[model samples]
Target: MKSNKATIHDIAAKLNITASTVSRALNDNPRISDETKKKVLKVAKQINYQPNHIASALRSGKSRLIGVIVPTANRNFFSSVIRGIEDHANILNYKIIISQSYDEYAKEVLNTEALINARVDGIIASLGKMTENFDHFHKVLDKGIPLVLFDRTADVLDVSHVILDDHLGAYQAVDHLIKNGCRRIVHFTSAQRINIYRERKRGYEDALKANGLEVDPALILYSNMQLEDGRRLTEETLQNKVHFDGIFSSSDYAAMGALQVLKENGIAVPGQVKLVGFGNEPFTSFSDPTITTVDQRSISMGKITAEMFFEILNNKGAELISKKTIIKPELIIRDSSK
Candidate 1:
């Protein structure tokens, strides 16, 4: 059976020219006249021509494709980061392949292997919560591929990364609550050993001490920082008679959950219990009482992460001396914290 797929040879025959000339025209070789290039492109569209990216990569030793891995894409933060990366990728004529880890270690490892097999020019990734072994990422470096980690990164991994000042962001949130007369505040945070959460917890404690408030272990609640976790923690606090005048959560979803529970129990926000959250998620603004949160500067983080990847690639790994870039966080004030 004969295939109907159009090739450069078919285009050449249609234009009464050699295949080499058609190829050069398609490649926009300076020697090929603009008139010829335009004609070739018109014919290509008419015939539904597709360029062989694999063949081009084989010839040029560059796939011109970037692979990105995220814990999950459902959040606004990760999506915005992807948009920032796309902004630069469009101008550089590079294609991006995005994979979601769903915060599973096995899934993350599989995604990394798959990307490596795809021969991507480079990879940008955020470590999954369950990931403890860095061998999969090490394989990428072992194969001479560039890997750039963003947001949730590991300090042990001797690689380039872009992150926000989690400590400062958390400190700002706690400080804001304290200034608002939240003398006995409840903190919801993650129990994971992840640096971001650890730093955030540190900031929370530091802010309390700075304001001459005692750091009460009973006020600290550890969980996955999900909506259910927040609700359960808040409920337990209410039931156990823990005296808390405010709630500061490390996740917006968690904070929203706490708010719902508080309102259900007839607790007035800012009047009885002030609230603050992190991750400036969209719903924080439109809630009945707006939420005060910290902006992670995700877009800027993404742009810087992509730029660092390119730098490593262009410099042939010379810039991979474990350079880390930290973006500042902004504290967004709203009704919840007022």
Candidate 2:
């Protein structure tokens, strides 16, 4: 029950013209008259003639495709970043192939190999949570393909990277809390596995030390950046009588968890315990007391990443310079941190 594939020969036969003439017309050849070209195109459309992408790619030596890898496509931040990349790629006549690694190192390796086999002209990647190795990325560099890193990037790779200014964002958040008469502040963060988290923690510590406040080891809580983990940590803090006046969480979801637990324990926000979080996720603004956080400028980062890739592709003589572009994060003040 399969339908036969239509070809240029079918159009040529119907028009009583040669296949070469049909090919030239379809290609918009100057020698072919407009009337003949229009007629050939109309017949081709009627017959549902389709061009082979593989054949065209082989002939031109350009796939006009870009590959993007992210930790999780389901997250709001990553999805927005993908949208930004797609918008820019579409304007430049390029298509994107997206892959998710699920924050696993092995899956990241597999995804990189698949993209290489597909022969993508460029790659944009945000490192997964468990990705600590850079061997897979070197394969793209070995092939002379342009690679751009965004968000969570590899410290070892010497490539173009676009990321938010994590340290300053954290500094501003903590500084604001201090100005609002919050002392004995606590930092709830993850393991120092990535630059963003590490830098944010450092910023928090530095702010406390600068303000002549004692940096209590018991107050710094380390947990997986998850809602359940946040809730568990908050509950533990209450059980142990930690006496924390303020908290700075590295994730909005975690902050939400902390808020719920504190409310259930009859603790007032901003009145008893002020809080701030990172990554101004959508839910931050809609929470009971709107959460204060940092905006990562994800869309602009994606556009700049696409722009960097095309710049390398267009430059014929000059070698592309590997550089890092840091986009500063903006602190969004809300009622939660008041």
lDDT (Cα, 0-100) at 69 in candidate 2: 96
What is the C-alpha lDDT profile of model 2 across 1-338, one tens digit per residue?
Answer: 96599988899999999998998898789999999999999999999999654555666667778899998897788888898999999997899999999989999999999988777778899988787779999988888878889988877998888888888888888888898889978788886878878888988988887888877889888887788877889999999988888889988888889989989998999789998988889999998889998888888888888887778778724776787888888999999888
Give the total clashing residue pairs for model 2: 0
Q: In the order shown, what is each candidate's alpha-carbon RMSD?
A: 1.8, 2.7
Candidate 2, clashing residue pairs? Answer: none
Q: How much lDDT does each candidate structure score?
A: 0.91, 0.86
Off by over 4 Å in 1: 1-5, 18-20, 317-320
Task: Kindly report the root-mean-square deviation of model 2 from the true structure over all alpha carbons.
Answer: 2.7
Deviation from native of the Cα of residue 266 in model 1, angstroms: 0.7
What overall lDDT, based on C-alpha atoms, would model 2 receive against the true structure? 0.86
Cα lDDT for residue 117, model 1? Answer: 79
Top of the candidates by lDDT: 1
Off by over 4 Å in 2: 1-51
- Residue-wise lDDT of candidate 1 within 252-275, one digit each (tens)? 989999999999999999899999
